[model samples]
Target chain A: MSKAGPPKSHPLFVRITHWINALAMILMIGSGWRIYNASPLFDFTFPREITLGGWLGGALQWHFAAMWLLVINGLVYLIYGLVTGHLRASLLPLSPRTVWADTVAALRLKLDHTTGRYNAVQKLLYLGVLALGVLVVLSGLAVWKPVQLWWLAALMGGYEGARLVHFFCMSGIVAFVIVHLALVFLVPATFLPMITGRAPAPKTNEANE
Target chain B: MKRDKSLIAATLKDIAPDLKRIERRLFLRQSLSLGALTMLSGCDLGSGNAVQGALDAMSKWNDGVQAALFSQTRLAKTYAPSDITPNFPFNAFYTEAEAPVINGKTYKLQLSGKITDKKPWSIADLRTLPQESQITRLICVEGWSAIGHWGGVPLHVFLDRIGADKTAKYVGFKCADKYYSSIDMPTALHPQTILALDYADEPLPTPLGYPLRIRIPTKLGFKNPKFITEIFVTNDYPGGYWEDQGYNWFSGS
Candidate 1:
């Protein structure tokens, strides 16, 4: 506020975990797709080249290995976000009204990201995916150990149902990745902050890029 | 050692039609772009032996975690007959056409390792042991499940009858098919785990292991090896067919 410029953004914990989570999610989704292709839920299946493991056995190995990272890193990120209040500062205050307005403005290409505060649409997407990330892990546990975690599996509608929910949760994260990448690419200035912890303030005399 | 990308796609489409239900729907996900990822990882697109070793180690680690976390007394849910999968799937390393025809007339299940009664038992003798049946789902590692009424002497009955050493570490099975497997000693004694010889109250079908099978409801299907020809109790480790191939040895689900 004193410098009359865009505030410094993205805590170091957020950036580090973001990149690690990005890596883990990629492997998990890829191998997960390979596993899915082995016995798909319906008539359509994802292409194999896009899948992670080379075969059924290999995919399973990669999936289980990568699972540790996703679970552990995701938990660290969540806890850190909570303790630091970064989640509240950047990702909270989502409501139907704000989300509706933000979504409308976004579709019309009028919503702003340079304000250094997350828009309602960004908050909703991040928070929703955060919640879904927890579901993904829980549902994964349900699928992974249906007997030991019968209560969790029952919450997911049982073993078969948990598999379905896990797949959809993966889809939700994938969709988030797509939208997230698009927005970042379109606004290159925001991308550097995730890596370097802050972006240069917009020059007051200069036209917005 | 090589893969045909299109064939993988075709196989997925083929299996999808067999999916169980309307609530069971499919979805797609994303991965790193192919070229950039390949260059970055240097994981051999072929062989991948080093990566495979690392993953196998990881699998072993997971096996330890699962074994520690496993609950001995819990039972997999029993399903109503109406909930049974319409056509209980026939899963094997080879197709049903390749199922070996073991001559049941002379077929005797051999026993060995830390047991007092080592005499082989005929299929008929197995059927005569105290029998119980339950309709339970056999969930596969490949993400589909099917339920069937499996009836036979509980595995613990067989183990106790043979006087297997109570503190042994593992129970191993040799299959009539080339596929063989083993289970942790505790899982070998689970209440629902059976040396199943009958399906739906009839003698086992050829495709479902005609003479005998091991049905441990708490485990994924692969852990329930079919076409069992020999059983043993061992303090030494007995690595399985798939377990040797990098799957978790204790593949409970």
Candidate 2:
């Protein structure tokens, strides 16, 4: 809103954490696909071409390794977002009516997008994906050490059930990513701000103000 | 337009050194992301020795984490007799037809390493020791799991009877099938660790380790060596067949 300052679309910390999160997600999901292929719950398996590890052993190594990065980096992101009020400023104040209206606008290809500010639809997707991320990690721990974390495993409906829950959470994240990437491609100018942390002020001062 | 272009070029030149430093950092990050992308695309770019080495190191670190989290008092879940998997599947590097068939009459459980007693005990001698039984799930690293009833002598009791050096770091096993594995002393001393001799209240079938096996409920299925011919206590790490092939050595389930 201040014309005197640079139009910052993202903070430096947010940019760093976002890219790191992207890397971790790719590693976790790719290796997870390979792990699933080892003993698929469904009849069909994930295609080898889309998997990370060359084999089950290799995949397990990658999955275990990337987990630390994901969890630690995720914690940093959450703490920074909450303590600095970045989370509230960027993504908050959503109602069912706003979401429905936004959804209708999106369907009609008429929704307006502003740099640094998430729309109602984006808010819901981001929050939903964040919740799914937490669940997937808990379910993973339950699967990894069912004996040590018996209570967690039980909460997820035991070892086998935990695996199913983990799988569904992963699916949800992948879906969000697909939609997110598509939106970014549609609004190509949104991509540069994430990298450089700033965007040129829009021609209309009223929108930014 | 020409003046603006020259002005931008002058700014870039002025910060060339800083740009170079930023580029170097970007290179590292980009390589990592690129490696991950290639791995997902099923390219061999991620198979380089550097990536493999990093992954191996991380796996070992995870091993340490899991060991620390393992509690002596925390026991694996036990199931009722009816909960046992019907027709428990036989699993091994070798097929069921190729599984070693040990003769109970001629079998001698050999002991070596740091143990004070190097004497060999026959199958009958093992039977004479106090026996225990439990129904526990055997989770495999491959993601499948099965529950089976196992009966045997507690490994710690056997170690005590054999005068095993409790201070030793590892308890290693040599199987008749040429398979080998080792476990940390803490895991070896876990209450659920047993030298199993029976399955489903009957003598072990040939395909299921015949005369002897280690039924460690705390570890993944591969850690439970079958057709064990020798047991040794030592400070040396005795890696398993699967473990040597990249499976984590301390694959605690």
Candidate 3:
């Protein structure tokens, strides 16, 4: 590790918001599963053991409570990402060819595990999940207040349609999380930097001296 | 070789505390399990833990927000007659077989509280009022909904006829089925709110509140109490059966 480069691989605000988002996501998803079991759209139900609240009423409490955390923290993250140009700088220039190449490399276990740089695949995933987050929140609002937020419900194709959209968006987020966690475990060095906000400086050819 | 070994040992010793701290933080993050979330929810009502208290406070805050967002002009969507759910599912805290069978002949719609006229009107007397019909959806808190046809006198017209105190905060219902609920004044006066006397153009079925029920499409199904025996206008919060148990009081849709 060299001392010549900037110490933080992730900015202070990014680390803080990331952890809060993680907490909020866990709470929301666990309770939301219990709520879904009340009137399941699909044949299968989420197992009771994995669900947060013991019953539907308790689950509703958790769902409504965690929503504020998710929304406010998400807003802070979005504003910071945009204003600081972190989002643009890290996730931009994502082309289809680059994504295809990265996907192949990732599958073959040949992609570079660069500490501070996002590859095209990573950029696409991050951007896609962010969009899903916004959609999930909007659809949730429509379901929660179909009459008061009639326009939103209409945009989602009405009350029943909004519920379907919300469920699918939640599914998308869960999928992204699975991949995100697997990547972290595969490159364990990345996990520490997310917590400590620093990474070992990238090895330069001249550093061999 | 001996000098290099000593230098490596010294570095390990220096970073031992930082490594331990990272491991501890990672362990804490990994232990964010469902069990921890269950404890945070404090699922048992009346247990006064900080987490439960915070959740309760947030639920109350949401109630206020919903109330503020409610608009007199914003009506629940009405469905075409063909859109009505065939055999709309019956829902209540109790089983359908337990639904009270009221004798429509002897039944009287009782009025109390802030109303100037305390007269009890019978089914025949209610029929004289102008009746309107709408096919509107009834959404339940359990995430299910059904659309049904309901015909009755608009509640505002009834309230006016009874000389109800329009400024009263709540209009509460006491039902023959022992289920009670209340709605805010604005909701009570909503153009679509009705004292429904018929379902599907037939004298209300026994399972569907029979003689009379308050048909409020704007709120959750629980808020629209069936088999209503008394209607009271009051300033006090008359918490409903389900609401007293933890459902948001102002659960406006």
Instruction: Give candidate 3 misplaced runs (Cα > 4 Å).
Output: A1-3, A201-209, B1-48
What does candidate 3 score in Cα RMSD to the true structure?
15.1
CAPRI-wise, candidate 1 is acceptable
lDDT scores in order:
0.81, 0.84, 0.84
User: Once model 1 is optimally superposed onto the true structure by TM-score, how far is the C-alpha of residue B97 displaced, in angstroms?
Assistant: 1.4
Model 2 scores a TM of: 0.88
Model 1 misses residue B155 by how many Å?
0.8
Give the best candidate by DockQ: 1
Among all windows of 10 consecutive residues in model 1 chain A, the one with the lowest summed lDDT is: A200-209
Per residue, candidate 2 scores C-alpha lDDT tens digits across B1-117 of 434554466565445435534543343234344366355335466445666678778878988998999988899999999999998998875446557778899999999998988
Q: Give per-residue lDDT, candidate 3, residue B205.
A: 95
Residue by residue across B90-132, what tens digits does model 1's lDDT show?
A: 9886546557777787999999999999999998888779998
Q: Give the fraction of reference interface contacts each candidate recovers.
A: 0.61, 0.57, 0.53
Model 3, A81-141: lDDT tens digits are 9998988988898999999999999889777767667888899999999999999999999
- TM-scores, all models, native as reference: 0.88, 0.88, 0.88
lDDT of 3 at A96: 96
lDDT by residue (tens digit), candidate 2, A1-209: 43667788889999999998998998899889989987898899987666766667777887898999899999999999999988887778889999999999988977778878878988889989999999999999999998899999999988898999999999999999999998777667778889999874575433333
Docking level for model 3: acceptable
